[model samples]
Target: MRYKLGWASRFGVALLMGILTFSLVVTTAPTQIQGAIAQATAAARQQQREQQVRQVRPETYDLSRYPVTDANERHWRNVLWTTGVVEPQEPYVAEAIAQIVSLTARSGLSRPQQRTVEMAMQIATQLYFSNPTGYAAIGQQFLQTVERSPNPEWSAMALSALVKTGLDPQQRQRLGDRLRQRFPQWNQDIYLFTTLRDLALLQQTPTTPPLGDLLKWTIAPNQVHLYVICRPDRGVLCQTVVKDGNGQFLRENGQLWSIPLLLRSLHELSWNFTRGQTPQGIYRIEGVRPANMETFRAYGAYDLVKLFAPYEEGVREFVPGRPGQLPATLTAYQALLPPSWRNYFPIQQSYWAGKAGRGLFRIHGSGEDPGFFTNNNRYPKSLGWNPAIGCLSALELYDDTGRLQQADMPPILNALTRLGGRSFTGYLTVVEVPGADTPVSIAEIEAAINS
Candidate 1:
């Protein structure tokens, strides 16, 4: 939500200041001046990326159009699965599992490389929907990955996988205790702590939100139900829906605005858990990001509402565009709403997730179709609605002549703008409400809203 001078502007200002001094060296040696200018420009750009990263944890592609390369088949496949580009079935899932197995047999790995750890986590997450709770298939094997190095990143992910295995509670507790003792040395790592916290939480049941919490959040302007469970009858479909309109948020002027957020991501991970698909919780609506070469094929042009999770690293200063005195604690996050809402668990999912270290997020449309040719998707993929890592993706369709056929994000933009004007700063609450086995029919949401 915060804006700053562009890198070019900053560089220009610095150059102007330097020119005003009229240095003899600058006048005499053009090459040195050019090199200095280049260095200054490079430094300013890097600073900008870092600053932007704190508030908006955009995909690298979003930042600078970095394309996924398949020079390394293992990495490419993992990327495909992680990005939801490919479904978690057949050769894709099988091959990704094989890559993790292969990583184990290799030698000369005293410590896992950064990419190695990251790719492993990526595959491990999607593996949940594929393997379910007892992630037994990949747990022990990846534990070896963690044992290879005591590094926190590897340790955090490996331990996360291990906790899902049949590890005893007492043993898990002791191990977790030991790790926390070592945390201070690593500057009291929050990711490590929260990662383990998620492990412990998975072992227990979540506190059920009161009915009012579910009702209010269901009709909230930017509601998204991204947590999904695959049932026998429904396959894998979103568990929440609305009544009057399939997906609309009512504005203050009493107008029914449609943002078309009928979304689905079958990342079996539960509410508030970012270790899964899109998290359930409060997010700050921080405007949009137009499509780039890396994202255009999947996400279309001039769209994408950036959702900033509270407590997200670098976004500590951002209070979601909700009313109330600004407070930043996990409990304080809910205080932005009415007193009655502070106790709402479902609406607070993302606030917890941000504190746990999953931050950069968005609500955008994708042109990619997971079920265009093959029915790889568990349920029918509506409007080419494919999955995104942790984003709430909507349908944005176009016709042959590039005429807009269907688009959902623009309305979402309008609704948020109505709530927060040009900055489009508002709170987006994602929750996992009732209903399973059957699809959340349009009637059900309408009934709920009307009542």
Candidate 2:
């Protein structure tokens, strides 16, 4: 049986013990426990050797001052909640105000606890969107701590959290300036991706457009935005761009993959239920789905994916009935549909007239099996290209062992959710540019980035 890491308890007490024990082993060990003594001695020697070899401090931080507050009850609760401690009574989301107040008291924190504190701040940021003035003091305190910390892990978490605190433009500029100095070079790190996004937004100088022609479609002018640019011929090289309400680019041209299937043309939405041709044109994301039984049955785990619609241009609205109660004409089409595609609900419905065989199209993970969508061995190995029926493309991140898994998607999904908010209800325009049959060139992507 494949061992699935339980999210709620994945990094719980056991992890804390391991961290604490690792710290203890660095200092002392009893000679009675022969095996543990040998291990500890060797680990201590290795740590000493590493420390001597480099002036840079070790990656780990001191968490002794963590759970950073006087109120022990609320501190542990927020910590457990942040760390995914799954207990029935200990719900994930308590009152946002309580979490914010609890976090305010604490000062010195390790990288791990800083991350927890960041999560708490995020809850407050999302909750108090209308009135973020209440969090000004908390944001400043957290910002000062992050600014003082030299550890990259802690600084990265703190800086990113500071952005979400809804700090004023001056504060955002200060954070951005600090980030630019720290992360001078750019790789595919998502944290840096978000940092760059906030930097651009804070600057807000009406700079050059990031996504080029894709910007034309995303002109709705909303607080949250997602631009999915599909290059069907390029397969895995689709680009997902995110922006704040003021049209400032946040995440510029991040890598995202899609179903490897190619469309017959730019206009084709889908051919069948299973072998879907990615539809072109604009679609609005009306719903965000969490993992459920149906999802688990289909993908081996409950993964989050946004449901988009007007499956194709002018093709909106299901037949006037419930899921199974399709009209006679629709029923005929449903009989020919694949089992997986049947009974899919619309996140966004349209009342337009001309309707063809277009239904569910979502941006989802690669599921439990990396090659599950492509029959385990039938597809290309490029993340640039994967298989999707008629759905917009998505990615399931690689695990620590470098294997793709469904569970790895949560972090990236959370990033998207953070950009769009908890509900993530917003405009999602999917633009497909045709005639470029070759895989998306690196030059083209770089141009998008620099633009």
Candidate 3:
């Protein structure tokens, strides 16, 4: 009985040991499997990170080697849109597009090819604004390229982008329309002409002449205003205090003149004309009268001297006398006038005289009289009078005659500066009427003009 009991105990102990071993295997197997799964997941995650990095890595491109043809422009466009091309460590896609556009435009390509590049640039600009990722970098590059581009389209595009980012929809639309109309062909001539016209128009008051008429009369060279004209024909006629047959003030054809030709002649005389052989006293006399020497001293001679000095260049020899001095040949003066002003003399004369008196004198009255507004009234308020038209006319005269000097150009410059002052900076706002009393900053105005 003792032996049988001992055998049963040993069997029970063996069964218990087997059970313990099975439990140990069951618990450790799951732990091992879990560790393997964790390591696999880590490896997969690392691989994905590496792949993403590679995708965005910069690839070398031979930009110069790529032929800049209209057909190839599409390829450049695609490069800009490709994902991950503008990563931080990579060449910026926006910068690349700008470079491509500029190079393509200036590559001596055909008109169609140039146009294609412009279209591509416009599309790129649109994309830049639409997505606006890394927009600051994109904008900086765009501005740099635009300033360097000869194509007007690039400038217009840059301006539009600025408007989009800085201005409200209404302002943006208005400016965009104006820019589109002005730069329809994207050539320098049209672009520069439109820019000047728009700048002049902005300063126009209700009393200003029609835009067409203003353009016909006003001439500008290097963006400065010279002289103003009233009529376009009979050559610039005026009433000045000259020594006349009766020693009285008389109105006559003082001289035939334009600004551009005058400046050219003056420059020639100053630097190129033969010494002594150059004619003396080229200005013609209109009349002489019992006049106020004080008036002559205050404005007349000074004004004429300042007006003529642009052409003098230290070579002009003039007859030293009273306010009324006549010259032998007015040919030099006549040549300076714009071709558009040749037949419109009547209007040109009136315009010229009116401006000479600082819009303070008028011809509407029976005799030359003070304008309705006093000189005191000629402050910022008086800027409303067709000052833009007058200024533009003056500029035209200067441009035609080459009389527009860097100095003595404050009045015309003031008109432009004031006009530009009506805009807002880093943003756009459209005022339907340019002369509205809306307050604007000088900086904003400058930005709008430059843009």
Candidate 4:
């Protein structure tokens, strides 16, 4: 009986040990599996997040793919308005402007277009100021659209509206001044002027010349005068002169000339003097005489010739003992120019002249000598002679000589093409005198031109 009892006790102990081991295994196995699954899921989520980051990274916009055109302008305008990319109260004003633009597009009608839409909204805002209860709701809606837009034109229009709403005089003046300084072009819009004038807003007067002058100067189209003077005492005085048909300078007239005029004049001058000249070109520098020895020392004669010769047939004729003779060291016509100007002349002259199958083709002066004469009649246009009509004169010369090339164009096209369709409008706005910096390269310029 004692042996049987002992056997039962041993069996019970073994069964209890086996049961405890099985329970421990079951609990630990699940925990290890769960931990492994969690780690895998976390790793996969991290990879997906990294991929998402890479997918949405901003890419450089290829301007060439979207060249400036009427269609592209319309498309971009629509995209900006529809996507609320420009204006804030986009839902309200967007549909209105879009409707107007759509009607114009479909009917092929010529409305004031963008400026017209802006003017209409501005008028509405003005009406709201007089009758706030009647027009305030719509004015507020349009104001919201103006606030949301990144477009400068819309911003100008909205600010104009705000001025119309009778803001504090000082505040209105400040805003008007800021807008004028930032966007001088917008200041020319008649709609803006009329709105400001009617509201008695403190806006700057438009810089446009009289209509008579504009019509008279239509021969020049858009041209400004860039004068470079080499005085006897003063070394060099370069000033960009803006002139209307009345022959009054812009500064003297107390107004900014049209930007188109400034740009055209700058481009024409750059093409003629810096680029080079031909019979077709109409720029000329007259009455250039030998300077005193001191004058020669202050401003290099060779530099002057190199600078001006591209545009004119520079002829220096002075005897060794001549009363108005420059220094003997400044004997060479090319040597008269500064080292920098001398070096740049050939490169610039060649770039324009060579491409056109012509040379700068100007005569130069010999050492302190007096027997130089210009065949002004041989090259009537090349002589330092410019007609009253600016671009029209040049065009007439090209037409008379039958030299206007149908295909060959200035190197500007090539340069623009290289810029990948970016407009040279800004860069071309400011006119830089020669010997400032090297102009853009031919290859790069070709790109900009083509674009």
Q: What is the C-alpha lDDT of each candidate?
A: 0.47, 0.39, 0.30, 0.28
Instruction: Return the number of clashes found in candidate 2.
Output: 13
TM-scores for every candidate against the unseen true structure: 0.57, 0.37, 0.24, 0.19
Indicate the residue-level lDDT of 73 in model 1. Answer: 41
Q: For candidate 4, what is the total of clashing residue pairs?
A: 32
Best lDDT among the predictions, by candidate number: 1
Which is the better candidate, 3 or 4, if ranked by TM-score? 3
| Alpha-carbon shift of residue 357 in model 1 (angstroms) | 3.6
- Which lDDT tens digits does candidate 1 get at residues 1-451? 0111222232243234323432421222445433333322434335533443333223321212322223344444434344333323443344344345435434444333334435555556456445543454555556555454456655555566556544688867865666666555533565475566665665683564443434444323343322221222222334322222224434323432233343344443333344346665556655666544344435543357776777654442354244432366765666555455566544565666676667668776654433331223444423245555577666544443333344455544544544455655445555555546444444554454565
Stretches > 4 Å off in candidate 1: 1-112, 127-140, 143-207, 211-276, 291-294, 313-317, 320-328, 337-347, 372-376, 381-383, 398-404, 418-420, 437-451
Better of 1 and 4 by lDDT: 1
User: How well is each residue in 181-249 modelled by candidate 4, as lDDT tens digits?
Assistant: 655674355333433433342344223212222212211222322221111111111112233323343
Which 10 successive residues of model 4 have the least lDDT summed? Answer: 388-397
Query: Which scores better on lDDT, 3 or 4?
Result: 3
Query: Model 3 scores what on Cα lDDT?
Result: 0.30
List where candidate 2 sits over 4 angstroms from the true fold: 1-211, 234-236, 252-275, 300-303, 311-354, 371-378, 381-386, 397-408, 434-451
